[model samples]
Target: MGHAADRRPGTRVDRMMTVPAAVSRSDRASATREAILNAAERLFAEEGLFAVSNRRVSEAAGQGNNAAVGYHFGTKTDLVRAIAHRHNGPIERTRARMVAEVGETDDTRAWLACMVRPVTDHLADLGRPTWFARFSVQAMADPGYHRLMAEESLSSSSLRRALHGLQASTPHLTREVGEERREMFRHLVLNVCAVRERELAEGEPTRWPTWDDTATGLIDALYGLMTAPMTPIGTIRR
Candidate 1:
């Protein structure tokens, strides 16, 4: 048997200390990563996504090592995806709840609300001075980064369900017209939200009083756009 002195609590205490030490390092790394993500999103939103550099992001994040971005996130595209993912989870949950509420409905406005409200609700939950809306617009506008945004968006099962519901509600639209209107809806929502986000960030008055109102306006406009009569291709003069 070991002597009492040899078996004293020193070894046990030392072992216990290791856990918190490891946790502290992990906490610090996570905090650093968050900082880098916030800085990168803001920079990307303010400047064009292609115009901003990883080194600039790191510097804005207050990292002394300019390579901190590259070390934490592999590439610019990876960093943008990470920023998107941070917000996507909450938005997805909200959309899932909305979809559940309006299950298998042919109501066009209901489907449009499901598609629009989740996003605006998320923005509202984020409070003012958010960068995500602007960052998303920048990503969607860029050819190189557009696919990344689309992939992240399509990965949401709730969004897919909402879109299917929308399509079913508007059976009058031919496949080509449906596709064209879908693009229009995407541009309208993103650009409108981006404008609202910029105005909020700049402390300027917004055209719509609230996010809910903005969502309502979008749904109304989309309903008109989707239900509009299609012009015959042959009737147009080239």
Candidate 2:
């Protein structure tokens, strides 16, 4: 009985010792993964979709060999997908929260900020606005990335639901035209913001305008144009 008891302690110690080593390995792997993602984000943003290679990502990540990208993520597509996925979660959650917060407000201004704040704040938090911003523009322009974005982003049903909720919350937007136009205007805002981001990163003179100005201008113009009664196109010859 004593012999068995003595062996029990040794067995427990063996198990306990293995855990920290396993945990340490896991921590190392996690750190490596973050490094790889950070490097990939920069390269993809600066160079565009096709410009960045798996080998370059690995090298920039400080990994020892080409196997790292494959070993960790299996493929270039998978790695970029992972990076996008990682950012997408927080973004979606923030948007959802803002949507909910605006639920009680009757003002469309509050609702408008709810829809746009998440995006602007996300870019602000990234600190390297150029990285995610450029990637976003590329995604918007590239059919492949657009499909990927649609897949990862809120589903159509979810978007409609959110829009319906927003319409319900904002009493000023009663007509179908108002609601539909608002949604289209929101998309326009996203498009303009993406273009501005790309221009800023390309070292072009952004002194022509600011992102916020462009954003607000787009939203205002859209709101006015969509809400205003339509005039006959050819009749407005003046």
Candidate 3:
């Protein structure tokens, strides 16, 4: 009779019911971490990274325990890195696909498009009132936290590939000048997106009606910047 019970359909149902206890605990923990990340990102974006405390993030996340941020992410730096990692994965994947589609092209605009669109597209997909662009600008603006953003970007092979292609397409630039323009490009994208994000969040009118339009305008500007002739150093008025 016990052997017969073990073979019954009801016995399988009983075994399945036992799994939810551990799964539920895990799901709850995951949900808590997500809430904390979302809260931390918004606070850090709006109030500046150093100005916001772990305790504040905890409360903002609706966690009764003030130590929740530390409990899940170890330190504030760790929490910031976690936030970066969460968004970086999707952005990187998008860039990789774009890179693959464009292949090894000498087209500067194509490479620049690959660089700019992934970020704007990701922001667009995230819908209105997204915090990541502002959060990224804040992170990059901080001397201590700037390396975190650089490291996250340098880790992406797709970004590296796109940059290499962009540089290769512009054979006229000296290595020094190329590096300078690269820095300018980075700042332009970051600040533009951050401003657009702020406008959207605050219900203000935007320069571009949509993220795609913004990307198009950015790519055009970048193309001109990249292809523009450099002034001769001997002709300087200074």
Report every candidate's CA lDDT.
0.93, 0.68, 0.93
Sorted by TM-score, highest first, which candidate order results? 1, 3, 2
Model 1 CA RMSD to the hidden true structure, in angstroms:
2.8
Candidate 1 colliding pairs = none
Query: 163-209 in candidate 1: lDDT tens per residue?
Result: 99999999999999999999999999999999999999999999999
C-alpha positional error of residue 13 in candidate 2 after TM-score superposition, expressed in Å: 1.9
Question: lDDT tens digits, residues 1-238, model 2?
Answer: 3443333445876778778988999999999999999898888877777777899999999998877988999987788689778877666777777666655555555555655656666765665455665666666566657667656655533345455655665555547656567757656766666666767667676533655565466656654644466444467555
* Clash pairs, model 2 backbone: none
Model 3, global lDDT: 0.93
In terms of lDDT, model 1 sits at 0.93
Alpha-carbon lDDT of model 2: 0.68
